[model samples]
Target: MTKHIIETVTFRLKDGVKPADFAKSATAMNAYVSGCTGFIARRLSYNADGLWIEHIEWQDMDAAKAAAAGIGAPEGNRPFLSAIDGPTVTMTHTELEVSVN
Candidate 1:
């Protein structure tokens, strides 16, 4: 199986908006992304600066794209545009090779 990684970098939250406030929205995103076709596993991490990291493993590239396209946009993402300190960045990659220990 091939693995796909999706890195999400979000700007800091604006005044009156806390990351905690968007916890519910985050969960919805998780569910939405996890339901993708090639989805095998997923991991999410965040930093104080609002940088979010996501690692997802898929069966193949087609599956990954299908899943991501289906994810669309969730309400939580609005905070990034309106109240976040900076713009959000996303990077996606498909594995060409991998190693296991």
Candidate 2:
């Protein structure tokens, strides 16, 4: 079986950026991502302490990598990227293990 890939991004919003504004960006980003090949699911979450995390699931590593390489090319993603505190952004990709499910 082909294991899926999960792309995790954790970051902080730029100073003065509201959560609602960030949410709007996330919505736009999801719209663009959903149209990509192998996109499975996407979820964005936050906490009381002001941290944001986005999880995106793909069919495999290649699909995840392909989407990431061109993520900055879309205007829809521009707001989302711009709203983030660049230095605080961290990302990871992990293969899904069925045994853990």
Judging by lDDT against the true structure, name the best candidate.
2
Task: Enumerate residue pairs that collide in model 1.
Answer: none
Misplaced by over 4 Å in model 2 are 98-101
Per-residue CA lDDT of model 1 for 19-99, tens digit only, reads: 676555555566566666666776656786666666677777777767656554656445434544444555566573654
Q: Against the true structure, whose TM-score is highest?
A: 2
Show model 1 residue runs off by greater than 4 Å.
Answer: 1-16, 73-86, 96-101
Q: How displaced is residue 82 in candidate 2, in Å? A: 0.2
Residue 67 error, candidate 1, Å: 1.5
Predictions in order: lDDT? 0.58, 0.91
Clashing pairs in 2: none
Instruction: Please state the error at residue 52 of candidate 1 in Å.
Output: 1.4
